[model samples]
Target: MKLPTDHSFFSSIRRLLHTYNLPTAYQLLESPPSKEVWKTKLNSAVDQHTVATWQEDIQEKPSLKYINTDALSVGKTHHLYTYVRPNRIDMLTAETKAKLLTGTYTLLANRAVFNQYAVNEPS
Candidate 1:
């Protein structure tokens, strides 16, 4: 599947950056990701409610940023497969980290689409 590069898509990326308070700065990795890898990551982010989990992973290890979407722009969906450097999460203060985490949790929890599609929620 080709990647989407429409306004709605970029809008989501922009929102992701804003919510994380991440800078627009990023560096692409040496190699582009393969289809399987891109699909897995994208599926994890959009389908599995794993964006927060991925962000946590990135925050825990700066190196992981290279594989995450730190450098976003308007273009083919394949751009998402490009490894980009993220903000130095390791440098964030504890309070700041907590706030970011909370923001992500809130966003995921409140997403209407997520609620509509999510299953196995605890009563």
Candidate 2:
């Protein structure tokens, strides 16, 4: 099945980055998560009560900054666009990571839509 918003390729890349490994900052902060804990978190994050979980997860860390959305002006045209605001060194606590992982999985379940957006790379 394909994924929504993106594809397995990006998801795998994220998994590699977030997974408990020698390269992650999490390992430096705490002991590596056990397989059970990882699976449990993944499952819990995607459960029916996801929004609440996401809120809690997001609140876990001291927010560096809130995501901002600004209207982009095309100078030459009247067209404007809303873009995802970025943050520097955004740290995802264990909760956010689980939410992300689960959210991606949920979106990916929609294979047709997932295929449609998977190749839309950001410029």
TM-scores of all models?
0.21, 0.20
> Residue pairs in steric clash, candidate 1?
3-77
lDDT of 1 by residue, 1-123 (tens): 766565677667776645554433241134556779856655545533445656678789976766535543223444322343444544344435555644544554566555756555678
Query: What would you estimate as the lDDT of candidate 2?
Result: 0.46
State the C-alpha lDDT per candidate: 0.52, 0.46
Q: lDDT of candidate 1 vs native?
A: 0.52
lDDT of 2 by residue, 1-123 (tens): 745444656566556545423234445347767789867655554442444444565567556125221322222332111221244323334335555644543444565565755554459
State the weakest 10-residue window (summed lDDT) of model 1: 72-81
Model 2 weakest lDDT span, ten residues long: 72-81
